[model samples]
Target: MKKPKLELDEPQPRKIIRADKAPTEGYSLVVDGHFKSHHDTVEAAEEAGMALKNRYQMLQIQVYDAVTKTRSMIEWPAPV
Candidate 1:
């Protein structure tokens, strides 16, 4: 028996917004998805982080900025 092949297509647009700082660079908000990367730029990374949080209610997320060579894990629901 031969294994079946799987095909992947471009992601559908759930929600897209023009980044204030990076106007030309837009962000896509996906549903029931997880994203992982080690790219630079905290702001950009955080934008994605917050998006995931807002959409999926993720309590925490990890971020790594190659440019600054920094890594940190951000958590939500901080003590008042």
Candidate 2:
């Protein structure tokens, strides 16, 4: 008897995002739904996330609140 071969596929976004676990004990900065950085406070993480999103409008940036257990997406600003 012959066995069938299996095929594996992976998603490749424009920018390679790190496959890391988000901070479970503090605020975290997530990029493209993947864990990016950890911050002591929510404000710091929010600021960094916003700045990165504002600079690169193509990326999906977000601020994750570990305490509240929620994630907020950083919407791109409108053209002036």
Highest lDDT against the true fold, candidate: 2
Clashing residue pairs, backbone N/CA/C < 3 A, model 2:
none
**Which residue pairs does candidate 1 place in steric collision?**
none
Winning candidate number (TM-score) = 2
lDDT of 1 by residue, 18-77 (tens): 233222222322223233432245677666766656666645565544344344555454
Candidate lDDT values, in order: 0.47, 0.79
TM-score of each: 0.37, 0.65
Give the alpha carbon lDDT tens digit for every residue of 1-80 in model 2: 88987867865657333447555667888888788888889889888987898899899988889888899887778334
- Candidate 1 residue runs with Cα over 4 Å from true position: 1-40, 67-69, 77-80
- Tell me how far the alpha carbon of residue 28 in candidate 1 is from the true structure, in angstroms, after superposition: 15
